[model samples]
Target: MALEGLRQRLTDLPQGRFGVAVSGGSDSMALLHVAAETLAPARLCAVTVDHRLRPEAADEAQMVARFAEGLGVSHDVLSWADGPFARETSGNLSERAREARYRLMADWARERGVVGVLLGHTADDVAETFVMRLGRRAGLKGLAAMAPVTHFHGVPFHRPALDERRAALRGHLSGAGLHWIEDPSNRDPRYDRTRARDALRHLSAAGLDPDDIAAAATHLRAAEIGLQHLLSDWATRHARTHRGANLIDAPALFDLPSDPALRVLGGALRHVTGVAHPPRAADLSRLLAALRSGDTRATLHGCLVTRDRTGIAVLREPAMAEASVPVPLGATWDDRWIVIGPGESGMSVKAVGAAGLSQLGNWREAGLPRAQAMSGPGVWRGETLIAAPELLPDGPFASKFARDDFPAWLASH
Candidate 1:
């Protein structure tokens, strides 16, 4: 079927307003065009986020607005005023951009009261994602790829074309008398996804098709779902969640079927606490062992999870207030007489270089720079570089710390 297939998908969606994220590229533009036509988006809006990374990015956003305007759809072009970087060269630029783009669209949807946000991930993309996750030692859950409809940050993400093939979308665009821009980055070797795309094309040419791959993913997803159902029952029988703790019977987890044991408990832990993906295999095993062992505590995701006689308690790391409470020679204390500088009335501070800072403990992984106190009360925000004591204040970015007798704790969240 054609993206003519999309007409049925659009018909089933609620009649309420929706926003499409259009980047002026073929995939997204095709979605914007078809969705606007079917949804009669005279009330719908197109949000174009200009990352300003490309020289033509602003122009591309403008083009998307023009396209929406021609369709009588509302349009807005949002640009970054100040962000991580105008052009970040770090390791995961595309991933970071994807995160930023979704966050921007969700915020826009909330403001405009849009019911959902349409995305343009097609069938081929889903197949590629399945294969890529397989390469990364993924289980069935990861191989299932993106869901067709997922709610995030108060907005629903709709990939109405998850069921539509890529060539079909192009054909539909041609049939609708519309053409869209192609991004050259897709062929760039600098990105790993391009290599994966080429590999998938190679595999497909050798006789694999989208339906075959999608079917495999569907099977995997089903198996995982059944396993999850079983594990949910197991957890209910043996696990307990309390105000500040969760008591999962470690022995019971060991007794459950292995796959369900890992996937279910891992997912439960993530949901109960604000955690990212599951820990690595070794970390997870060690953490489980610590729970049964005599260890006092083990930290995970900035909090401590400890095993007690009855259950496990997860708590925030207590402040290290007693450590170096008095001012040392070269540390800071809430921006007051932190270093060996001429003190100003309202708390003066000075700066020290890399040499002045030393390893206070094995907390470098804590994300805060470690420094020794040489002079006043040493202060920091959750191991972050807040202010040294008025007696000793020396560290990089130390000069910027300000002190107000208004009480620094008052201004804190």
Candidate 2:
């Protein structure tokens, strides 16, 4: 029954090469086995991310590779040891690792032209996530937890096992005479997820089942979707984009229900700043309160929001401006703009600082604030400013800014 369900999900996905993220665990191994049987070997590839945080991570990746090889499926191991993962100094190691894992997998998928990457998140994982979010006093979106399909850095991330149970997947593996590795961290009480899992087991014994929790999450997800549709319409009517900044009708937004209003401002701030996560909820609430009193200026999530005669303008925080960095053809800058090089060998992309703004002969004629214009994408060749595409007329080098899809972005993060 589980295999049939898995086969149906795989068949429903878009017809193209698919990438499976395998960690040599029971759930992931079951997914890989089923995928190998359901799809042609040529249509599937697997990637194992070795975070290198533990000594056995390398061997576990090799084990997954051997299993994939036996199934006639090509596989690759992406090491995080050499990337920013190695140099991370953040206090939240788990969050950092999660971010790094997705980043590496997304890059691998892009290079191989895969349509989507599949994960092995299961029903138990969803329940634990809900409990964790509940403990944190999260909003509806956070409690809703994981989705079956999401996009990260333009690559589709699919979790086909969300409806399946961990034990069921392990049972399938056992029945097939396959063995899987167990990460020690899964039982470590030091981690919040581990504690949540432990608590969920006790709660299940006390009559509150994990399945019931998962069902509640499903309902919350539906409510979240309904709110997103309403917010989309609100944004269309009251939000305007100018020179990479966002101008939202302040009075109109303030008139909205607190939740939707907060979401609108948060979405605008995220879009203007090009950050994956929205600003902290508490900070946003405080900002909204301040805006209600009178004209206000505040900063959050790398963006500056100011209420003025025109409206509320959300701009990239000048202090957080991206430094000049070399950008090859088809490369993205600041996660918001894509640099289109004019077949040039030496080109770099950066925020149009005061110096670059001065080079724009008739800057004021463009009708953008100097700070806002300075935050626009600028292409440079050595010491010469090539173009500030957002401020200037179409020219040689073009920077294409990605449109903000708030609902999709929020879900993925």
Candidate 3:
């Protein structure tokens, strides 16, 4: 394999242990080979996620393990057989599997103290994604395709080979006498990506090749970055967080252009809901239309959005805050609240529902809205309310919002 492309990509990465996600495929195998050669084996770790959707998946994972071990890189295999979609026989399996794969990798990266994981996405993948999203009538963000680096489950994933070609990677592997598994799913027309790949061939014949499309997507990515900067500036001026809710100056937000307004509202919703992606564009457009027509309340993507004379407030849906976790000091509740407890056992972190709120005689004095207060994290020992931090400033257990700063989170995302 040529070392120049991989070396150039590695130059910007921080000095730390890096994890490589290999799926026993050509692209990933090539990445593993190039990265292991470019970086010290001590600084390289390899992981494979077995989705268990195919009978050959386990063997494929073993193939990657053997290859990684041969290269003197530590390897581990993660399984998604027991994940949320283990029994899911319907819906978008591809999307769910991709999510599960990344979720597993993110946990592995954190546990292994790796800075980030490297992926095998290449120019072909980017072009295919652009074509797929174009068919969906996707806007700027979607057409921009896959980013070279992106965060999944809070772990940075680097696609260093985004500018490389799939065939080129395969040829390199072949030249090095390395072998890779070919997934049968790649040929399955039932998948959208397979169809997109077929469409790319026809498009290529018409002189619109993968490289051209990939380059166009790169330009779109630059444009999106510029827009994100504008959104960040606007968010800094108009968005505020109060009791885990994002409050925006409605007049100022609506005064902006439609695209900027949508970006601001979408960012606010994502921040409040802890959802990685923004709400569907159609849903957001409808919500914006309603808000412009004097609607005071709306809901989308597990958030409760309300507009008042002062501004718009995007908050977690009260019912969606039903997630709970044991009071293990550092345990997370609702994927956002970090529990800092009194080191007591037999306690669990739960939403401060109406029952817990009623127990706080001075709840109203806290000045938080009733809905927001109800969704706040509270330590409970069964029916007994142990600590309601949002209501009682001096509670025994104090909790912190993981994404406390809206503007900062907006800028980063």
TM-scores for the candidates: 0.68, 0.91, 0.91
| Candidate 1 C-alpha lDDT tens digits along 266-305 | 5544433323346566666666667656534666533455
**Comparing 1 and 3 by TM-score, which wins?**
3
* Top lDDT prediction, candidate number: 3
Model 1's alpha-carbon lDDT is: 0.59
Across residues 1-413, which tens digit of lDDT does each residue of candidate 2 receive?
A: 66677788988889999999999989899999988888887888999998888878889899999999999999999988544455456456776677778878887898898999999988898999999999999999889858788766667899988888888889989998999998888889988999999999899999999989998998898888777777777676787776678888988988999988888888888776655567789999999998888898888888888888888888887657755344555766665677675757677787778878778887777788877877777887777878887787567676676655443433333
Segments in model 2 whose C-alpha atoms lie over 4 Å from true places = 81-88, 323-325, 405-413
- C-alpha displacement of 63 in model 3, angstroms? 2.5
**How many Å off is the CA of 106 in candidate 1?**
2.4
Candidate 3 lDDT score at position 305: 87
lDDT of each: 0.59, 0.81, 0.83
Residue 198 C-alpha lDDT in model 1: 84
Candidate that beats the other on lDDT, 2 or 3, i.e. the better one: 3
